[model samples]
Target: SQKTNIKALLASDAIGSTVTVRGWVRTKRESKNVAFIALNDGSTIHNLQVVADTAKFDENTLRNVTTGACICAVGLLVESAGSGQRVEIQAESIEIYGVSDPEKYPLQPKEHSLEFLREIAHLRPRTNTFGAILRIRHALAYAIHKYFNDNGFYYLHSPIITGADAEGAGEMFRVTTLDAKNPPLDETGSVDFKQDFFGRKTNLTVSGQLQGELGAMALSKVYTFGPTFRAENSNTARHLAEFWMIEPEVAFNDLDDNMELAEDFLKYLINYALTHCADDLAFLDARFRKEEDKKKKEERAELGLLDRLNFVVANPFERLTYTEAVEILIKSKPAQKKQFQYEVNWGTDLQSEHERYLVEKHFKKPVILTNYPTHIKAFYMKQNEDGKTVRAMDVLFPGIGEIIGGSQREENYEKLMARVKEVGIHEEEIWWYLETRKYGTAPHAGFGLGFERLVLFVTGMGNIRDVIPFPRTPQNADF
Candidate 1:
């Protein structure tokens, strides 16, 4: 018989059928006459109870079936007598594929902290918490693709290595083939990038927005979902050396259209998770509550995970301008009481604390803040008629402040070139991007959603590193 996945088996009613199930043992409980083995194959969060008669299997083989052991059990499918699950396997034959020594194996049948799990990330997927997170991650990825395909969006593959800095952050991981010890230098005594692999200076792309814009100019509507890199030295829970970004660009769309699209897209994704990943979400919700319970009374969340998600999906996000948000923040209790870490000002960027106050305390719902100061926003954002603000928008969630950030791109060629020069970027660097405005440039807008941040919010995982597999951080790249 072919091997049946545990997820399919649990949802089916094939009673009295002999079947084969392959998985690693989660736990083994033995009695005088029978042994109950909880087995999981990383399908669903639940485990299948395999009843093995002690008399039917060799003692040595059973001894090897400890926790984390890989095994194949041929059994008869029957209704489970247990309380938690509906169906179970009655093992008629057992085969041990791999043995895990209980004394040395890192993962035991107990609760392990997230910090410890990071140390052994290679085997952390076997844990229920990580398994549920990974499953939800897959579901969210699928929902993103499905939603885009259904809404007439083409997935554009942007280049991994780029010459122009999209965000103008100047924090990029250098991509070069020059020798670090003794490399080529020009007459100016500077490292010559002309001798590099690409024959010019290049680095891992920081954002696909610029390349994605090129696609949108021709394709009318396009999105790029790919990995991006940064070389920042921060080791915060929210920061990562490598991350994935989802950027959607549309021609002839203004700031209002961009806001509408972001709101609808986010709602669809959250609702999709609530519908298709109910089981995993339930597990994560329970876990989220437990973690929240450990915090101080004042620091605890106002709503549970499921409640927060439901609220965001059911209601509309509050919309306001950056000026309004700053005014509100300055008058808020946190600001008046001097509790905020950073001061709220008109021209300065809003910090995470300020954003959370607007979403969690002020609006009490998701918010879409628009019309940010031009000095605080990117050069590509359309300059407002006021000459102080740009048509930029940031979608803020309850726990996560800014889940999405975008703007209406500057369509006027003269204005764009002026901003480019004002930001100290040479015209030769992004000549192609500048040309898009010169020739038949229609109003275009787009936003970027950090794929890891979305996963972190959906899975209710606190740390950004926990959501992505094999997290790349400063000085830590171990598998």
Candidate 2:
């Protein structure tokens, strides 16, 4: 008996061998002759089937084990008799490690709604989808560190409680101690933030790019991979109130350099995910995808398990300037008159829908959309020579829009301040930021990649909430 991955056991080499494994019973079926229990131990996405005869194992013991009960078993591994599965365990010994109370247990082997699953967040990890997601998340995280470390980039930890809102989207989750009903006020009658939790108007960081830029200035290359909070109330599948972002900032880099770095970085991530999270990827491919998608995946698997990601990582992303992108849109979909919904004349922020159309339809590959209007982009984006567009780029991929948004920072102190003023952002609170531009801020560039969004693209999960372990939404914190 040896410890082995369930997927490896089923698909690879463990036939006609005895193995001892511990796992939670997903569900069990009992009969007079034998009983079948589908088990998963977090080793892989696929469950290890355990078939035991009623004569050898106590019927009462098997009957008492609930859907989510933890169990340890020693058994002979044998090939499946029918077309059900590849491998199963023939039990020689059975031990009920922890019995689950049936009435209180949330998982019941039924297809539960995602909302329902969110409510049982504590136990949802036991399911196949979540199990695969966590594994992929772990592998991707490891790959990120490996990618940065191998490339001579310093790994910098940005503070969670920060004085800056980097996105400037005004989505900062506030951190305060003043009572909402009756709070202490300053002489000016404003709520006194001095007595707050951080002793100032502190908030959870919306993005780590700004602090990461500091490290980039010093170290030349640095990345901050950590949790970022957004107080945005959007409840779409793509948006999350709390999630992780990997912000890699580079010094003396322009928008082109930034796009190249982003492309390489994304490919590096996809490659790492493919090699390391094979089991998880396989699990997700089989279980979560729709019937047609699963069949498509099966056919794709015949080509390769990582074919889609391989195409992305190996292929050169098609580059399109914002103007070219707009032209392409105009020529391609002139019939749709709702371009009015975009609400911008020639230069403006490209909405998510526009980004999707460009990547999913026109490019049919990852697209690096660059040279956006300076008015819509962040203030830090380096002003292009045209005196209008900024050297900014948003990497959009098929099925996912704006996977990474970045730009070459505005190095000139005066112009930086002017843009800051133009944005109506309070310059007083962010003096340290201006100082960077003043004293030795080497033309820096960086991008913010939503880690969950990348997971969605890589795993083909379609929803950001499904990839994160515990999705925190405005009205949801069920478990």
Deviating ranges (above 4 Å) for candidate 1: 334-336
Among all candidates shown, the one with the greatest lDDT: 1
lDDT at residue 25 of model 2 (Cα atoms)? 91
lDDT of 2 by residue, 412-473 (tens): 99888888888988887688878888778688888989999999888877678788888888
Q: What TM-score does structure 2 among the candidates reach?
A: 0.90
> Would you estimate the TM-scores of all the predictions?
0.98, 0.90
- Score each candidate by Cα lDDT: 0.91, 0.82
**How far off is residue 161 in model 2, in Å?**
0.5
User: Model 1 shows how many backbone clashes?
Assistant: 0
Determine the backbone clash count of candidate 2: 0
Off by over 4 Å in 2: 1-18, 77-87, 101-105, 286-307, 336-344
Candidate 1's residue-wise lDDT over 334-423, tens digit each?
434387888778999999888988888778999999999998888999999999999999998877778899999999999998899998
